[model samples]
Target: MAIQTIIVGTGRHIPAVIVPNSAFMHHQFHGPDHQPIDKPNEEILEQFEAITGIHERRYAPDDLLTSDMAFLAAEDALASSGIDRESLDGLIVAHNFGNVRPNAHRSDLVPSLAARVKARLGIRNPGAVAFDLVFGCPGWLQGVIQTDCMIRAGAARRVLVMGADTLSRVSDPHDRDSLIYADGAGAVILEGREGEPGEGILAHAARSDTFEHSTMLLMGPSYRDSAFLEAFFLKMEGRKLYRYALHHVAGAVKDCLDKAGVDLRTVAKVLIHQANLKMDEAILEALCRLAGLEGAPPGLMPMTISWLGNSSVATIPTMLDLILKGDLEGHAIRPGDTVVFASVGAGMNINAVVYRFPRS
Candidate 1:
């Protein structure tokens, strides 16, 4: 039997505060020049919805911090896995921004979010190391990959990995891109299990292209001139980032599938990052083309962006939790199913993983 890192439980915490596109109608939109956009608000939002497929998104209440969301999701995972908190060998948390106060203009990260979550989970094992990962939007999947390596290397038997972010707290109200951000938390427990070949994690791949595209997704002052000039909000070179993802993200997914020696037709699902509907569609088409297919099979990809918006690192894991819990209609992963997870984000980074559900 081969030791494989397998997902034993999953959970997510989606905030109850819903922010719809109409909420932005009264706000003045600005371009990169800090000048007013010429388009009318209705036309702008209509096009935004058509492109991004985000009609609404959730926001954490002002009372909850990023660590709070992570802790909630972690508790859910622990309950689902029925794993003892003290038995966890490692705890990893992923996020781009630290704890950002809903009413303040600053972010905090003095004590790592993982440490805070460890305390909240009541995991008193000093040997159960806690740390954080900051790999952009691919952070959660990257955390999963790292946990796999640790288990495979005999450094850990069970690990808890989580991705949570409150992007709404850091978004610029004046920028159109701000409408694309949301907040949520998702987590999964991975444990080393002895299983036959072709189970659990099979292969993974990652890439970083910072030399030329480092600024594609970054932080800058508010798009509105002279407004909170001292504070920075999440910013992006929209077209550049879109083009970069289209050109590279598909290749990364294809590389992982090839390394796993799995054919595209055998894949049950491709859970790519939910950045934009159109961008993800194009990446799937490109991945199929790389495999000598004309296009992706119908229903091969499941998306939640239309309703959940983009929650950065939390998107994929949250989606996974929903599907596994029968909350996401029309999707299910059965035993022995092959699934591929991929994401692209800040750091100009990209990663893909091939996994097979364990056959009990």
Candidate 2:
């Protein structure tokens, strides 16, 4: 029997605090020298909203850590799947930074985050492995890809793939790049099931641009301000990132669909990484154009960035849970539908997975 990786359940954990764009109004902005550089707040916001389409986002309290968020999300996913944790075969965690504090730029690097979350879940199976995957923004999706291979290889029957990040802790609150991030976690339970046509992960494609790997996404050295210290803050070449996604990400999505022998019209939804709203819209337009789609259909590409901002690997899965569970008002998923998951970031890697929704 061919093993198919089917998503049995999904869950997410978002911080309690809701930060509107206005919250940054009076907050001090700083330059590389770490000195305060005050800009017209309203003008900054106008440009921000116009480009990113994000008005608000959630933030983990200074005390909250990446593993903490992952544990919360993992619990929800385990509960939703109704799967016994001890009986699980694998637990794979995806993340960039482990856990950081509000004033701390360095993430705790002692014990692996997967170990911490697995222990928190109280799973006791020597045979059930727990580990971490560091694959930049495509982290969680890469975890899923590995889980699929494991299931097919008979190394696991069930696996938990979770992506969590606390970019809020590492971000320089005053940086525009920091404005693009938030803290959150999303988890999916993948079970080895009988291969049912169009009812599991159908096809996928991945690519890495190694030449552009000069820390296009990077954290800087310690800052004079504790808030800015360490390699804590993230900086990026927005224009380059945008160009790569537009030129490559859409093509990757199209490739995955083609590999599945499906048409763009057959995909029920296109969930690309929630990096920027404007950039996402641009990618979708090019994607549709590549697929020969006429004016990309509405609601086919669900977005959570306007409210959630970007949580790195957590963005896609969290949005998937929100939409599938009907928590996301404008988007939806029905049984038997196929959804395309795609992302590009950090490692300059791009990947797309074609997933088929299952009917109960």
Candidate 1, pairs of clashing residues: none
Q: Write the per-residue lDDT of candidate 1 for residues 206-252, one digit (tens) a residue.
A: 99999998888887888886557555688988888999999999899
Q: Judging by lDDT against the true structure, name the best candidate.
A: 1
Overlapping backbone residue pairs in candidate 1 total: 0
lDDT of each: 0.92, 0.86
TM-score of each prediction:
0.98, 0.95
**Highest TM-score: which candidate?**
1
lDDT of 2: 0.86
What lDDT score goes with residue 292 in model 2?
A: 89
The residue ranges of model 2 lying beyond 4 angstroms of the native Cα positions read: 30-39, 221-230
